[model samples]
Target: MATAGKDTTDASGGPGNTATPAIRHSKPPVNHHRAPRAATYSTSILPFERSPNGNILAAFCRAAYWTQGRAVWGALTASGDTKHCYKMDHARRGRAIIINNETFHHDLYLGQRTGTDRDAENMESLLSELGFDITARKNCTAAEMKSMLVEAARESQGDADCFVCVILSHGDDGAVYGTDESVKVEDLVAPIKACKSLAGKPKLFFIQACRGKFVDGGVEVVDSKGKHGQDDEEEMESDEVAVQTIPVEADFLMAYSVAQGYYSWRNREQGSWFVQAVVKVVRDNWRRMDLLTMMTRVSHKVAYDFESNVPSNRFLHMKKQIPCITSMLTKDLYFTPKV
Candidate 1:
């Protein structure tokens, strides 16, 4: 239980005079082998054959198919074709602002977000790889967060493809926390949406926080193939976009870590499940998948690949989460990977 250092005022002097907490730079080792209370479900294993050249033929075939399919799709949705998909061929991929609120003021009564630094780090890395200039902040107050977003919106984005803002904090249904107070999620988006330079460009927001306090005790589903084995060892494996808007709200995508009235779980060492899933999914499939499709995979990964492992609290143990995605865009949005 390491305590955060004393807070200091933001140098930008935009708003909220409250002191910001010192950011924790220590990286804890991730625990990936935690035992589950119940037997884990396993995924089906696919058989593979090796070619005469010692290559995995199935893998090579799959790769080839993926590449060829994307090439065709890319041709169909060529640049300047806003009818089928948004153009992602600008000189810049645009800017990303990551406001990570890890520690709260003592008066706020909120516990520190133990693993959020990892989330911020991963998000920054992923967005940078996607060619967005990154502006990251830690432990901002509500006013400071709002001020930053407003300032970001004021910047010139005429040559950029899109805008992205990622907030990692404790939150309720429609808002997220700052160091001192909570800020409306809509307020965070309004500034960016109203920016004239980004009018037709995509605006993406990824919020990783608890939407509420309710825990989801997942329902059991019977497998169609047969009954599952009782032994723990036997049950081990398994696993958008658009835009257009002449409309004010069009072309914006809001991705929430959990559904309204549900808690979003985080590993004290590994960060939030939703952020991890988003980073991995985007990194793996951005070259071919649309933003919405990648987000759907993110939702599936968070919903099925993670479960709360709180052993001491029966009410919290084995809880589940499902991410919520709200899209207002009118066209398919893909992140055409940079050369």
Candidate 2:
């Protein structure tokens, strides 16, 4: 399979074309009875080549890069085999915790999160495709959010392969907002990292809240003249090595929708740019690419291709966003689907 210097069409069709989601002035009617959670749906196969010990063949991915100019598209095509993502003896099928913070009680914050519901629904579908048993919480408090994560990690026991928590809310530097107040991001992560049950497992955090109030202005770049689009499917690596446990937080990865000190964009219709971009990449390529690589593609599409078309008085320039990755992973992660 071809793995280097390939060109592909952008799967999103074109960027900056989707209408921005609108904000609602009134609160949604509180359902006296909440609906049952969406049923788990795992019908797809997304597998990539992995070392016998479940470690990824870093050498195989080392030289892969998209050409300078090309249609943005899925990194891996449908030609690849399907395997549920895996970990060595250190792990098994994992859990995904998604927190949706759409409403606030205070008038200072207009928390009518018009787009967050979509964010949660899409996240549930995406993570489920990779075999995660999902636990979704809506409109949590700073305190409640913490308790929920603790419950998630309570059974981790270093036996699960990974932990993924996605937060959608209003936020500022260093923290995300709850209905009542802001919860420092550090505090939210503290208990999860300290969970002895989750020791050595990868902890993945995807936060889709404003970091601050800045935006990105796109720059021009030259494109590569490769008129070809070829997707090199990843093949399984036969090398099996011993798998050992590592530090609990050492494999943690946090992907923020925007850079620190910047604002995140959302559509009342399409949901937040960050979450939409993330779900799209994982849905299209989870079986063929690693988490980080998929994220890089997401960052590219959201940053360079998407922009806020909403009219703003306080902000004059067209707004743009890019997802940031903070990782301390010791091994590459590949989410495989069950056959």
Candidate 3:
């Protein structure tokens, strides 16, 4: 089994410090949720100029073209092209399970995961709004977690369009902690993958936990606007479709809160940066973007918008994180609003 490591402490204690002998392993804390302060810099371009090239007409035309393109694509996808996208017209959206493990067993030596309830609450709200039937479990042991997941997988999914599992806990590379012990990430998802009823359906796993102990001291870069601005598939069909069997791993999307070998950051009063960004991005853009696209936005929000601010611990201060997405989805996934 993977060993748990020290993480951030509660609001009063410095990061990586435990009041007792047992090791506590949770996300490092960010004292605040706001962006870091930076010195203001002036840009060469005038504030009134809307376009980089200084051509109002050209900028207007480009904007119009992009809007038109998006409309066209939306129309196409809204028509339900099953060949390129998952069919989401089921009577029910899907079943969603959230496993939130906050406090751990004394023998486990893992620290209590502070603020995880916020993450769970946010996730529950988001998924519920998206039409998923939510099943929430808190502070489950490893056996209980495995049993619950297996039972969930076995539940009839014929009426459902997808499956979602969100885990908020302390973790190491490839494993997430239950209250009593660690469970392999793969083991957590294997039962779902083997669910015959959910074959060819999207199975999403959102994991908010540390993958390792490494910290990211983000690199600084000048804004391009200050320096003069600027900035920055496919399907197949077949007749006879001979005994088509989807790969056990197909349609699985695993979103990790942090890159491997790094600590994921969380706010003691709010939630993990990754989960908060996911809730915000999905709520804002799910109607217009595919799951992968929304996840990309989630990664961006977490990477650029959040940073650790543990002034009490120099090693944990100003730390950064980038979410990792592993997708084996065979088609575009859109969470179209329920009628």
Query: Top TM-score: which candidate number?
Result: 1
Estimate, for each residue in 1-339, the C-alpha lDDT of model 2 and write its tens digit: 111121111122211212222322222122233333333654222121232323223312321322210111223224332122235333355777888876665532343556568888888877765667677777777788888787776774566767888898877667787666667787778778878866766789999887765555545558512121123211110111122212325878888888867767666555777888898888777655678888898887776556544232224234456677887776667664332
Regions more than 4 Å wrong, model 1: 1-17, 20-73, 78-82, 223-248
- Candidate ordering by lDDT (highest first): 3, 1, 2
> In every candidate, how many clashes are there?
9, 21, 2
Q: Candidate 2 regions off by >4 Å?
A: 1-92, 223-249, 311-317
lDDT of 3 by residue, 269-325 (tens): 567788889999997777667899999988877777766665556776556778999
lDDT of 1: 0.69
Which of 1 and 3 is the better model by TM-score? 1
lDDT of 1 by residue, 234-270 (tens): 1000000111212227888888888877777666555
Ranking by TM-score: 1, 3, 2
Best of the candidates, lDDT: 3
Global lDDT scores for all candidate models: 0.69, 0.59, 0.70
